[model samples]
Target: MKNWLLHILVNAIAIIIVSFVFSSVEIEGFIGALIAALILSILNAIVRPILVILTLPITVLTLGLFLLVVNAITLAMTDALLGSTFEIAGFGMTIIAALVISLLNLVLNSFIKD
Candidate 1:
């Protein structure tokens, strides 16, 4: 439970930071960020693996660069799910924001133990 909560917190912080950093990414408020983070967490856990597998050929062909697109897809999914509260404009913006979120997650996960 503690680890789970920390994970959510990390996501919330990452989303907020990304939104602040990118004009195209807009998170309404802390609550909105939290909700977006939760949905993104769910999507990443359940959908990311399938997407990575489904697009493995492209991922391999691109020498793993296509994984960034998959991450952007998940980010776009979060925006679509959250609607106005969490809006990410354009594919490029989504990809950049996703990259920031991924880096933040990586750093936070390193500090958090399961």
Candidate 2:
């Protein structure tokens, strides 16, 4: 539970950074960002694996590059579900935003001992 909360916090930071770095992505406020982050985490943990399995052939053909598109779609899905709380404007921005969020989450999670 603590680890999950920590992950959520890290994701919130990532969302803020992504929103600032890319005009296409936006979080209305800290609360919205937090909610979006939590939603993103849930989606990644649950839905993403199913998606990867369903798209295994394409993923292999693209040498895993298609995962980026999958990430973008997830981000867009988060935005759609959360209404204006999260917004990813375009495919290009989605790629950049997803990469940034992933890197940030990895770095932040590393600092967590548990």
lDDT of 1: 0.91
Give a tens-digit lDDT track for model 2, residues 7-38: 89989998998788877788899999999988
Q: State the lDDT of candidate 1 residue by residue for 1-114, as single tens digits.
A: 788878999999999988888888899999999999999989999999999999999999999999999999998998999889999889998888888999999997898767
**Model 1, residue 59: displacement in angstroms?**
0.7
Error of model 1, residue 27, in angstroms: 0.5
Off by over 4 Å in 2: none
Worst 10 residues of 1 by lDDT: 105-114
State TM-scores per candidate: 0.93, 0.93
In model 2, what are the clashing residue pairs, if there are any? none
Clashing pairs in 1: none
